[model samples]
Target: MSTYRLSNQGLEIAEQARQAKRWKRQDEKLARAALVSVATLKRFWGQQPIRADSFEHVCRALGLEDWQRLVEVEEERSLDFPQFAWDEFWVGREKLVVQLSERLQNSCRVLMLAGMTGIGKTALAEKLVLELQPLPNFSRINLDHREKTVEFSAIATQLLETWKQQISDSDRRDPQRLLNWLVSYLQQTPCFLLIDSLENVLRGSEQTGWSEFIDPLWVQFFQKLLAVETSASTVLLTSQDSPAQLVELGQRYGHLYQCCVLDGLTPEEQMSLFRQIGLLVEDPVVCDYLSRIGCAYEGHPLALRVIAGEISQAPFDGDVQAYWKRYGDEIERVKQLQQTAEIEGPHDALKLAQYSRNLRQRVRQRIDRTLRRLTEEVPLAYVVLCFGAVYRRPVPERFWLRSLEGRSLDENQQLAVLDALYDRYLAEQVVMDGDLMIRQHNLIRSIALDHLKNLQP
Candidate 1:
């Protein structure tokens, strides 16, 4: 059996042209036969300019329809991965998929997927398309590729070949007309269309660009699609952010679903991901420490991956303190870079010495200011907090608030200080295990501690 196939109409036309016995003019009849043969070849393969005479002679000797049909069937089939593959990809966003599917299933001509960076929203959208890939008329357009520009006319051209329609010159050029033809094609054929990274088209520019041309064109095209009396066609769009105008239109028409916010993985999911990524830890102590850091960082997949990559290359006998020291050095280098341009002084032999002394004094004063806020007496609490931050884990509030004897703080004073910190946006209170937990962002904590460590009386 041949792997590709032509439509029955195409096959019949080719057969009749081949079997034509009465040649009123032999040359004209031969030319028509050659034209039919070329059409068949172009239909099976894509548009290619080749000698029609040779193709016609071959088709006359063999019935190529079955071979063509089989080839087409095989070409349309999707591939399945090996069963033993690692499958590091995400799974089980059924709720979000169903929500999107329902919106696509409803009156909305388009559905948009929006989420934060690195949340796996694109994976979910691709998964949905994979689910729908078996459908005959389904097609996808990836807008992320620089070489491709998606216009209604281009979409219609791809659809024409996929649907095996007779390409009329008029149908190929008119976007509005082509869109109507596409809607009709989709209605009868039940096609699923996916437009990925649609944020590209939605981005506006100060100069004339795609946002000026494609945006309004797609808007009108979608409006026309919605107005059409169709039941089966669906268009799914994936973007980083929701298109404001489209969202407004969807709201007015009550066709949009509530946007789903994809968040970082849960602790259990993060563990599973780590295992999949080939990080196997048998030591309970090390595992517990890494897990604490992971939880503190909100189980953000990228951050966990970075930490895992660092640990995987570090010496097996290396301690957590060594890792902290290495990371602290890197942080100090970054701090110096950040402060370089902010430093200023005069240039004279005596003045230069005085300027250097003044700069050192100012640095000490900054350190003192940071330490004073953390504690009045020892001023070492800031140093401990900074060292703790290098581990990328939240320090327990009691660790910072403990007295010289290491006793827990009185509730009233603790609450007052916490309230002040919250007001100043220095620390945020997170709820964990039914208790108020205090934590600061990693960068701020780093700066606070770096200053405290440099402080001298």
Candidate 2:
């Protein structure tokens, strides 16, 4: 869902209502009565973007909650954005949004939206924020593992920056003091903090299946944050792995904590979203194909988006059928990725498989296809990815270019390949200290390394 600005008539009405209010503490009263922040009430009057719920509360607080009560002869529409306008884009998640909004408004102080990468966790977080508009101090922390601190000082620093508050260097130097300052601030004012991709900090060894990636200080910080009872604040975390402490806390204090486990989209959502990206249509002939694509990718939004992006790019140029025809050879691999979610039929092995088996296979297939295609089309890029994966952190562009020594391709070819991979979302590049640093996702890196390992035999 999305927020909308108020209409001109609505703004005028709000102004009139504000002037007509006799009580000096009217704003405070309305805020408490409607569960809307005073600043948000101001934004509504200023014709700014606001949640639908906020709009309703503002209207009700002004005694014009219903459109029929207002003399809106000029503009027929009271609300700037008609209902379900932007919501049309997010398919089949209306109920989820409603539930999430209710939880945030009611009590779930710390909500964790957990799912695999590219499963729309971040998108949902953004949508929820737009729909609920929790509070003023909203900060989205995209967790990066490259900058490992002794005390996760970066996360704390980012949160403080978002809140526009300052802390002494001495306090920041000490982890416990910084955390205490943070908790104290949240205790004072409401805040919405979304920590995305927490797995970077908490993920265990991929091969061994349970190895902590870094010092558990960040984990401890999250635990402390989650345990706090703040009515006005909500901390949302999106992770692949949900820490047991968070779950246990949620179980004990259901109102203050919630662990939301997300899965792939339904077939309808897949097709609806696909239609937006020009990947699917309403035709009966295409219906089966679209449904199959949905199933093959198991309605993973990122996987579908990648395919759509590739189709819109060069070689295919928005020709979905042509793109399929050109790379149709990879259909076998696609099917291979879709195949066998579990060990076998009617076996105890199949019972032991996690629900994310299909999604992991889907991710594996995506990385695998990219690797194999790069090997044939852009071998230099393939080499770069392989070497970049060798280092867990982001690799500098210079390193990749230098590593291309004695190879047939030059720097330009490597750069072009890198661009293609980055654009396709297979590779990620960041600039640190004036040099471009590139890295792949954990799943992609792991799969790519495994592919290399298998080739050695």
Candidate 3:
């Protein structure tokens, strides 16, 4: 059941009503009058979530006629946005939301959420746009429309024509003029633009090695946006790969551009997600079992959600142990191996595998597409990833480089390949024993190990 608290104005009105009724201000007295526990009374007064029934009783106790009137209203969104399951699936990233919100409001002009597929970049971007609603103008273009591929020039022309009705036909026909009109209009009119699946518009095939814009007009548009001394608008992009031009522009205009790389959910966050989805996490044994699954997946959001759904359904019926009883063998073995690796060293750690073959199709397919792209475009980076997966725990940068010593790459080329792995969010950085090290997620390592096997000796 959903819970709610009093609105700010409602709280003030409730206080006045209480005083008019000549009620004692003591918490004990109020709790007795409201017929709720002191904890519930306190929760009501503190503006924390309380049951609707409890809230109504408290409101009646204060002589307020309408309890519904006192409850906070839902936030109103002014702009038209595609609907998403924000309340259901969105969890964690609280700090990230605050950080990005501040940057977008104050300093940052163009922001990008860059990460691997299924990493929730699009979800987070949608969340940001929703939270910042009621703006004067808002527009979004999803580049993932395979049925009708969207072009940069088309996007710019549409925005210009819609926002500036008086735009000359000649300007809309000319790419440079169309971009200039859009940029100039944006500089004056404060707006929020969200572009999703930007990689669809990028040159990411085997020939291009990822990141270059398919349409040169996009490069010019972004350059002009960031190069401008000031702009009244901001744009947010979600992409599987970071745009090379944006990276270079970020170097030149550091203050105006920001790129946030997303990773998997934390263990604590994963537990919250499991509980939210009706999994039995209250039991310590069950909690521990789920935690191990999280470790096995390395807190991958999609994988954890899939596993949680399985446990919450049918014969399992939210019985984590029962789910474990069937699927726990591999998790148990991985747990033991991880413990041994901490002492025996990473080499002793067995190569981790993906989710059991039967259950991993969705996450597997998603990750497979990304890995296939990497394998085709930047084989050197892909090779580094395969070699680096031999370590079960985070290792130093030198070790990743050391694995490539036999290859033809020089120092600079090797470093670039390592950077490429990081840029694509394939390699993760962690601090262990007060020293920073590199590691790969279990799922990625599983696939990488498979690729490593196919490499010619």
Candidate 4:
């Protein structure tokens, strides 16, 4: 019984040791992962070296149960970005500004905003900085211009210059010391820091050199800025892609707010935007049709603007179908040119070379594969479906199937083929009259018909 009791105690001791070791490992990892040197970390932690107990104490103080949770919280905080006004170009994302303003007023540490290109992410960021300009403590650093390559040192220098210009400069030359002093100052009097167009900085790094992309100096600067406990200040960042590194920095320093992904406009918003653009559409039928097609185009503001421009220039002549057909052809042509440029390379010389080599190759492969899959040779039903697509109207499946009596397909088989086409993105499915209406985009339809005509003897 005594031996059993001794074994149990040993087991408990071993488990406790294991837990302690795990905690120590995590603490070391977090310290190393931070974008700062030992000295900086020591300074941030009040000149105390991070031992196992001290690390645990720090974790406990931050209310983090584990290192992973701490990391996650940090990442989440860094991804938060303030909403700006200029983001009205895209659909469905104005609420972000209100949320950001609330957070800013509450003195959130970091906000990161992520969105795709042409989504007006930059414009929103700019507007946020403009709004924050009235505050004496507000300062902004816009890293948008492609020509400018900003490093940590450069950014630090800019911050110092901005500080000196706005306030005063007692000590200016030493970046490290200046940054330290700035952090101490910010802790006392909070300020807003805006980092705009991080994509340009990341891309520039890839083009120039990875070493140049995220300089150690910048990392240290961020680390220092983050370490400062400022109740009044918030850092806002805007990027096209995920700012993983920035998030990491935020984790090491302070709380990272939620990330907002700005999307395109709603149907109502698109209509409002059209009205703002000064497009006149008095007829209810035409307006409804325009709204339907506009919504169908995924509420992309730029596409709506393009459609609006086309409509304004060429007023509809009492036939909605004719108007759509005319503009559709022009849009398809422009799309084709754009696609060709993208696929063949942006440079004219390279594009010509690529186009010459791979002309009709993909289309031919698709045709050959499709032909092999069909049980009979070139069915008339398929031909009619393809031909109707050229009209840019949803053709009823039953009408086309009945039109080809001799080449009639099993209903299930016909549905399967349609599904296959849709899956391949070669066709689009729309609902009309409570029936599944399959139609191809004008570009795809034009290409398909051209291929069919060429196949004729």
Q: Determine which window of 10 residues in candidate 2 has minimal summed lDDT.
A: 344-353
The total number of steric clashes, by the backbone 3 Å criterion, in model 2 comes to: 2
Higher-lDDT candidate of 2 and 4 = 2
Candidate 3 Cα deviation (angstroms), residue 338: 3.1
Number of the top-ranking candidate, with TM-score as the measure: 3
Per-model TM-score, in order, reads 0.47, 0.55, 0.74, 0.46
Against the true structure, whose lDDT is highest? 3
Model 4 compared with the native: what TM-score? 0.46
Per-residue lDDT of candidate 4, residues 1-457 (tens digit): 0000112333344335436646432232333233122232342234232223333433443334453322222212211234433422233445766677677667466676765433456666666664555655556667756567565545666775666634335344455765666666566665778777665554212111111134555556556656555545677777654444555565554444556666556777776655443333446766676666564444544445545534433344234455566554443343354344232211111111012112234223433334332213224434544544443356555543443356456666555444433322345557898997666543345345554554446
Off by over 4 Å in 3: 1-79, 84-87, 145-151, 161-173, 204-210, 341-359, 398-407, 430-436
134-160 in candidate 3: lDDT tens per residue?
A: 655788777775455546768887776
Q: Which portions of model 4 show Cα errors greater than 4 Å?
A: 1-94, 127-133, 165-174, 203-213, 249-255, 281-283, 292-297, 302-325, 329-457
Q: Rank the candidates by lDDT, best first.
A: 3, 2, 1, 4
The order by descending TM-score is 3, 2, 1, 4
Backbone clash tally for model 1? 11
Give the TM-score (vs. native) of candidate 2.
0.55
Error of 2 at 71 (Å): 31
